[model samples]
Target chain A: MLERTKKSFLTALWILIITFPLMGLKTVFTGEQAEVGIRADAFYLAGVVFLCGMMWSMKGLIGRGIAFAVPPAKSCTGAIKTSVMKVPVWCWQVGILAMLCAFPFMGSEAELNKYFSFLIETLIYVSLALGLNIMVGMVGLLVLGYAAFFGIGAYTYAILSLNFHVPFWPSLFIGGAIAGVIGILLGIPSIRLRGDYLAIVTLGFGEIVRFVLKNEAAVTGGEQGLPNQHIPGAIAAPSLGFMVLDREIHYYYIAIVIMVLVVFVVHRLNNSRTGRAWIAIREDETAAMSMGINTFRMKILAFAISAFIAGFVGVFYAARMNFVNPEAFRFEYSVLILSMVILGGMGSVPGVILGAVILQVIPWLMRDMMPNLLREYFPSAANVAGTLTDFRLLIFGGIMVIMMIFRPQGIIGNARRKIELGVEEERD
Target chain B: MFQHIVDGTTQGAIYALIALGYTLVYGILGMINFAHGEVYMIGAYIGIISLAVFTATGMTLISLPLCVFVAFLAALFFCAAYGYTIEKTAYRPLRQAHILAPLISAIGMSTFLQNYVMLAHGKDKFDFPGIFRAAFINNTVQISGARVNYLEIFIIAASLVTMLCLHLMIRYTRIGKAMRATAQDKKMAGLVGININRVIPFTFIVGSALAAIAGVMVSMYVGATKFDDGYMAGMKAFTAAVLGGIGNITGTMLGGFILGLAESMGIWLISSDYKDAYSFILLLIVLIVRPRGLLGEQVSDRA
Candidate 1:
């Protein structure tokens, strides 16, 4: 124990020295003067580093104890597959739907906006993740700039609504259609390239889309984006025939409905012949072509369909937020969405939703929601509550690296994909 | 046109410097080192921060050249260390994993590095000490017919020397031969007694060291550096690597120049507002026409 403690101290000291220039000294600009301030958080960092080193040293001892609590993915997936079901799958799905429908009522009347908005946003992401899953999971196309389509769908609706006074209902279909058309156009020349090359092309395309949106000041309002913040009530809330969706609860119903429709469409497509052809192309394009699969055509179809689904959420998100900005459509946002798809195990519907929820909620909880809740409920532990807020993204990055290192197949990844990703070679 | 050529060549040199790193890593691993751009960005930070620290400690007062030299050395050393550590921690374990694993992990690492700098350095752009600019600020040289600033000329000359040194090192050195052997066939190279582990980390170290040169130079030239600047520059360098043929060293250098020239000429012809679009358009056209880039490629079909 003493030896481990000594080693931990050495590791922490090393970390401090290595990171001294960057983390220890901080540059703070006040007015016109620049000053370097020593960050007091160095001690905290050293403590954390020491703990990690000790944890590393005692891995064998801890592993046995932790193994029983958290099962390996192989066994976890097997448990899901072989476990006895008390009720039918459809009944459970219906139960979930009913629960979702009753979400607004579950929350207090005053907090309807707060609670429903959260659910609404979650549902929107669920839809987006499912849409991205079409191309990434089923079709096997890696799109680095899927957010461009989302931005397009959003900007299309926002522009049409604010300028032409077009209703949200009609703009939904129009935006999705426009996005799908753009997808087909994008996929035409680029789809012929191999997977890795295609990744860069898509990345470039995404950058081009963002740059164009930023550059075209007149159309996109440049960096500030559409719907000027200074001018309130310029853009109205989305409306049904009865009334405008002026509250979060109203938007919640629409989001859940749209999400279900997306899930159904995606589920149907995944089991369809077209989906199989796309998978064939992904697995081995040459073989797929030899089998007369019309690989290029199938690839294009996947792009269009996936882009279409992402487009729907883009419209809903813009309408719900009553704002559209180029900032929302950055490469980082695309990375976040791609993380969702990859985290969920690419082609699995439930996996994608679970991945979306975990990535979304965990970060959200760390950044503001959970911390605030903790401060409100437990005043004594306030110091430790939001301490993780600043490092949420750093923690997130570390998690991604660790997750990929240990389980590249992802949590509840597709069985075949799990094997393909080499997660099963450990033979748990 | 003459002035634009000088500007293009200077800018292209920087891109080429960064692109060499990308192509070299891709040659070895057949995976895109997504955090490479971050390494370059971090290089710039290290350079500037070191200068600030030196200036604060009265080292610059003692000897300005010595301080600058020390600063450059610090930047190169730290960046190379970062590259080696990143590869060891995030990537080395996933050597046999699927392509997506390493790619996503690199992206995550890139994000972490960017945010780490952002948190430490603050999100605001910081000014470089203008060590190089002092010599080239007002000095202009007649190149062909155009009056080119010494800084631009210096950038071009520095880039050429760096590339030449890299070429010589790779061509003549034992480590270079080992690297080439590993790139061609890892199994064979291992059979022939080359340590794959040593070669991979060495490749990252060398690439990162080259990126440090570009980072310091660009920070010196631009006068300011931001945390997120790497993403775009990195993308363009990756584009350059692909345009030249991804794994080919000579081709990447040529690709960087072509892209730089194309962007400069495009900006001169069109509006500067659409500066970023020119590279993408050029990339699209080249990809449509050549498929394998200008010099062709030697990417292994394994992972």
Candidate 2:
């Protein structure tokens, strides 16, 4: 009993020592002016310290008591797997297609525009996530600077279209090719490195790309960024007025078609011999190399292909937004895309798409739909919902933390990743 | 050239301070504490408030040096608690989880903290009151056509003192021995009866305290700080850590100084518009030329 008391006492004391100085310092020193006097602020400081001490002690006690409980598995992988396996793939595809095709027709014009915008955004991420999955999910490379390719793709089309009056159709290939070349350049240097080192190196490349884009005013339009990005007018289609790519509906359809094409290619690749080689390298590079696989070429192939897909979507992104800016390609955006791939289930195509849609669509729905509903039923609550929108990123960060902790395998756990993560757990 | 060197040294000191935090944490845990930057950010905010408290209490009652010491200590204390809690909440549970889990958690914590600070302190930049506004600090000493401010001298001196103290502690202390043992091998350390849990959090506390000192000095040096200041500073410091060979304390210090000088000189040679790019380019160069870093021992693939 005495020992426990002594331990708790020590814990509280340590907490007190650490908490008082930093917390009190802030209240005492306002930046420009002294707002609250020291004597007045002393109580607040003391209260905070006491609270911290109490919390620390409680944690010590409660945490010990709870330590014996078996931890729940991080994700409902088994449950999801069983349910997903029960559904036939064709039914799932046809039903999804039917719903997507009928989406715009069901909503009011204003609602249709909003829904189309969301769908277009979703499609863009779906393509981006799928591309990233090739490197991160299949190749097992954590590419931290993925948005650099996205940036490259956008900038390529923007520069080509704006400068030479090149149309969007050809620019897409050019942008993808440019990004693919850059990806190879990055991948070659990174081939020697693994894990976090490669992650940082790629991150550095991404930043360099951003800086160059921001600095080269002559070509990239400097910080003002390339505005009024030109995309080709849509081709005439049966039963549709001259489909203008700038219009939301036409762009949405084009994006959907591209997204489908990407998914198909990715699915085909995931089942091919090359895909197996990539996964083998991901599992053990040395083993893969020893097995007569050219690990270097395959790794670079993953980078090139992934970057191509990113670049492909980049042209579409520029067209959809009708604007291209350095801000669109920040490190944060890369992390967000990576998070989508991770949360959905790394290496799972359907999982990543599900992850992207859930992350991207839910926030908008919460911000736009929730407040309107609340404002009608409970007017006062609407103001609270409005303020909650500001915390979207905060919630995203929380989700990332929670998801990683609870279910590192993600929403749709791949068989390989599940085994790997499981092996990791038993080692400790 | 002399001016750039002096500026670089001051900048280098801050980077060294931040780099040490990364190195210490990395040494103990293979995971990168991505939220370390946000911890520094929190420290700076706390430093601002602590300064306000000290000023409100009236500095006339005590010597200026004592008042300054008190303010720094206060900031360090609170930042230590923050570091402790951060590890407890974000990292501790993931200790045995997948490798990527901790990294993702750290990123999430960073994102959360950045936005949290933004909500607490408005998005705009806040002017950090120049407590050293006295002639002693503002006065410039010219040496060989180079103008050096006394504040720069103070910054360098404080950084050196902190680093020296850390060096002494790590070299001689029992806790330091335990930390080294644990870092060398956690399971073996546990077998040797060393408390891994305690050592880990203690390492966090010490790293955080160092970061807090850096945060205060930086806010004072720059004259203004924004909520987003930590991101750039953290990345540069992380670069320094990697350049020096991650987990090598001495290497981190040397790396920080070299990076600072390179950045300063690079900005002078090229346009300052690409100032952020300079460090990243240097990082890439270092990565390609010598992946292990200058002082880093060869670390084979753990797999």
**Which candidate should be chosen as best, given TM-score against the real structure?**
1
What is the clash count of model 2?
Answer: 16
Residue-level lDDT for B181 in candidate 2: 90
lDDT of 1 by residue, A293-394 (tens): 998789899899889887877888888778788899988888888888887677888888988888888787787787788899998878777667877888
What 10-residue stretch in candidate 1 chain B is worst by lDDT? B294-303
Supply candidate 1's per-residue lDDT for A388: 71
lDDT of 1 by residue, B70-130 (tens): 8778988988988998998899998887667788889889988888888777788978765
Which candidate comes out best when scored by DockQ? 2
Q: Is the docking of candidate 1 incorrect, acceptable, medium or high quality?
A: acceptable
Report, in order, each candidate's fnat.
Answer: 0.41, 0.60
lDDT of each: 0.84, 0.81
